[model samples]
Target: MSGAARAEHRVLIIDDHVLFAESLELALSLEGYDVRRLELPEEGGSMATIRSLALRRNPRTVLLDLDLGRFGDGMNLIAPLAKAGINVVVLTASEEIGRWGGCMRLGARRVLPKSGALQQALATVRRLHQGLPVMSPDELETLLDAWARERRNHDEVRQRLDRLTPRERQVLGSLIEGRTVRMISEDSVVSEATVRTQVKSILNKLEVSSQLAAVGLAHQVGWQQGV
Candidate 1:
């Protein structure tokens, strides 16, 4: 439980999907690897519950899914499982490269998109079983670098959004909804000049010269109008 698994060929599947997990378990079991799968618990899956299951089972490798439905983000368990010396292999339906990049950054030995994942997953597990690196140093570098670049851009967008006052954000949101300054002014029962001023302040705080640019920035960061 603390270091290596009690059994070298044992693997744990932690996906919520029943059919996929069963197919994988059957496949692995046929290949002479001991396999166990976690079903969605009575209450629902959770990071805490998944972590406890892994610790209790102490498999050499864990096959994880990101969107656990009721369980929430599976990314939360990657670091802890890796730290406990269990190899984490993320198998996800999401096609986003950012999410794949995040898996490696969080210590997943391999990440497989659910599309055509069977062969890739088997190969990864085989390498891991042999104590060989699943990803080359260069491939690992590429994924980690992509993760870093994405994180940097996300942080910048969040910082710019954080600079806006509540009123300015509401004004920006109105703009996002395609409301003109006059319309926003009428809704707020303020003068056109006042709404225009707020719009200008939003542009300044967002470091964009035009209202369109400000709106685009807000949208990029997933900002919403505050109540």
Candidate 2:
């Protein structure tokens, strides 16, 4: 495509985190994207509003959040955009187990954690422009391991994940979906204490002080692929 076409790639940031979302919008615009920023939707903005944007602007890609202030999830918007033939890339801070797989299965074209630096996100967008999978060898390894461990015991999996786990891998997938610790405990059939310990361990292993930090780290890496 010509420079104009490439420049026409509309990028929408649908995040509830106003500051970060605005920063992303500014950054992406600086990087040569036709960018639009939508503050986290209240009760998830009307699907009609989104459809209108997609149909009118026909953005080349969308930067979505998995969780949007409990109003609606970025995942909820993926299918509609996909049906409209728009490309979607997740730009959330969710690190729950199985979330990566779930987003992909739900038809998101790609997932890039906002924790990842702007350069990395830009690289992925560049690849998207070129019609290629953006994952590098290392990112791919982390992603696959993350997807795999969701099915295994947390302790058993953490040992393996430590080597190169996806940054800030979230608690079990269900927990991040607004489920309670007791609920997750009930679902996973583990004690609430055990769940808390696992969450702590995951936080420690990832070297983050909070759950959001862990989630953000999933996308940020000091290393580059094929270096």
Candidate 3:
């Protein structure tokens, strides 16, 4: 490609998989895009690196992945990259359709599953480069429906959580952290019997039949450490 062509079209890939990124870099380069791949760091400071690279390279598009080792989910980068006027296309192996809506809501250009055909993935990127919509009408509708159902489930979980007392909330947190009833009793300065009663109450309030189900509900509602 000519220097002017390279200057106009650049693609950056931020994925932790080195071999996959290198292969994608070669493929895109062969297709006349000035491609660069940054394998995400296993430790801290990836966001700063990404910002610096964006400023220096000024890539027109970024192919991103959600699982970035210890750096955490790459969804957090979507809004910032989009705000900088760079189109982001999520390339992930996650089969959850709700993630597609979440990425698009954060201004991603498209979400392409790694399970899809390589030629189709390349075509999607090329179309996005040309400012075309990647999703067909049926696909868009399916994603929206899945997103709506996810939102509804989230709301219900939050509502159920709100019904728990402060003490119950603390117990729920400990349970979600995989603590045994005896462990929770020791930490809370309560007897094992008291902790068992509290656990039963928690299960009833959370509308779950078992401790495992309650823990799953807690995760669905975005429970975190120290909650």
List the global CA lDDT of all models: 0.83, 0.65, 0.80
Provide the global lDDT of candidate 3 against the true structure: 0.80
In candidate 2, residue 167 scores what lDDT?
A: 23
lDDT of 3 by residue, 33-98 (tens): 878887455556766676676556677888888787766788988998899898888889898888
Give the Cα RMSD of candidate 1.
Answer: 4.7
Error of 1 at 27 (Å): 1.1
lDDT string for model 2 (1-43, tens) is 4657667788877676788788878887777778887643455
Relative to the unseen true structure, what is the C-alpha lDDT of residue 18 in candidate 3, on a scale of 0 to 100? 86
Candidate 1: segments with Cα more than 4 A from true spot: 1-8, 42-45, 170-227
Q: In candidate 1, what are the lDDT values of residues 1-227, reduced to their tens digit?
A: 22234235789998888888888888777666778997668775567987887878888899998888777889998999999999999999987676678989888998888888878888888778878888888888887788888779888988888888888878888899999989999999999999988888877777889988987877765778772
How badly does each model clash, as a count of residue pairs? Answer: 0, 2, 0
Best by TM-score: 3
Candidate number with greatest lDDT: 1
lDDT of 1: 0.83
Q: Model 2: how far is 4 from its true place, Å?
A: 2.8
